[model samples]
Target: MRILLALLYVSLVGAPGGSSLPANDSFRNTIQSILNIGQITLFHIKKLRTKLPAAPQMEFSTPSIDGLTSISRDLQILDNELQNPVTDLLSQIQADVSSMEGRVRLFALTMGCPVQARPRGHPWASLFPDSHFYLILEKVQRYLDTIFLNKDKLKVC
Candidate 1:
């Protein structure tokens, strides 16, 4: 009886069949890739901007226009890569992230917490208290914000 109970306990706790561990890892990897792409984009943008001659109108010169077009193409590729639903892990992560965001928002509203507090140490933050999910979402958001704020920095490389 004791051995049977122990075997059952071990099976329940150690099995991966019911776990989202793989999905979590995939999400983390995706977020890291996004951040790396953002860094590369920023670098390209800065290089192009620095190479430009100093003139208000010259900012939109031929070279700059060409660089911008290249940058745009790179961005499109990145967007397509992100949008591809090739892996079940990514799809699950995306769905979970969206659902978690919704739940966080709802919880915050119910608890009277500010929107900014939804990501971190807020009363309602515990709604999606899973560390892996939170970390992936936070990284994704950070990368997205960096891309948005440095939009002009994305130059053709």
Candidate 2:
């Protein structure tokens, strides 16, 4: 599962060594791919909730998944046109998403959380990539934030 996710990320985000962006699906498919990965990650996390240890809730508050619903509804309600400010904000948010995901990757390695494959026809991928990609990516960011903030929740014993 990790390998699958990695391949998808590399395909979409491209290699760090590249001198320029790979020019691969920079607009449409790139957004869709991110959405697909985000949806897949959420589905996997839901399944792993049982397999993984409980996260810390004493000092840090885990982000609520409910946020995604409103974000999604907002996206659906949006007209075909997107505002310049909104697009700019999404780009910045994507950068934060990337950073958060990076931190979570290390914690994921240490936790050794195993991912069960998403069931077939499970709507594991997002539909119609748009600004909603940011919404989905925001969801992924929240999951990563939860994992990174509770990095010590896993025990060796």
Candidate 3:
């Protein structure tokens, strides 16, 4: 939860105007929620790996990790530049995150890791499950679409 809180703080601090625009505030809230969901997904992945008897020798591609890192950096850049946000930028970033999540899901599948549904809890707490990485990814993507990428009308950050 500390990681989630730290991420939320960083995102809010980086966003432009500090809650002047309702849309921007909504975007910040959505992004924070996305990060928290991601943390839960990552936590489960780590827990599963540690639960293995002997680390279940598996070869994950380095490119996948590198790609994720690149996406994360770009997301940070976009978050920082939210003062003049670009719709396509967020769309592409959302797509990239989804792709990375897919890679993680495939990697887990190859290693025989199970993906489970979210457990019952507080609404926010129940957004993502330990094994529901793709679900978390989808939720983030959809939130970005609804809050930042509305095709019906453009949002000028």
- Decide which is better by TM-score, 1 or 3: 1
Per-candidate TM equals 0.30, 0.25, 0.28
What are the Cα lDDT values of the candidates?
A: 0.39, 0.39, 0.38
| Candidate no. 3 TM-score | 0.28
Error of 1 at 98 (Å): 24
- lDDT, candidate 1, 55-83, per-residue tens: 23211112121222332333332233223
Q: Which runs of model 2 end up more than 4 angstroms from their true locations?
A: 1-117, 121-128
**Ordering by lDDT:** 1, 2, 3
Query: Which candidate number has the best lDDT?
Result: 1
Model 2, 50: alpha-carbon shift in Å? 35
Give a tens-digit lDDT track for model 2, residues 1-157: 9999999999777655562455333423433443454455555545544554554332323343232232222222221112223334334333434433333333334335432221223132335444344444444446544533443332210
lDDT digits (tens) for residues 20-101 of candidate 3: 5975566456445545445554444445445434332333222112222333333333223221122232333334444434
Number of clashing pairs per prediction, in order: 1, 0, 0
The root-mean-square deviation over C-alpha atoms between each candidate and the true structure, in angstroms, is: 18.8, 19.3, 21.1
Alpha-carbon error at 145 in model 1, in Å?
5.4
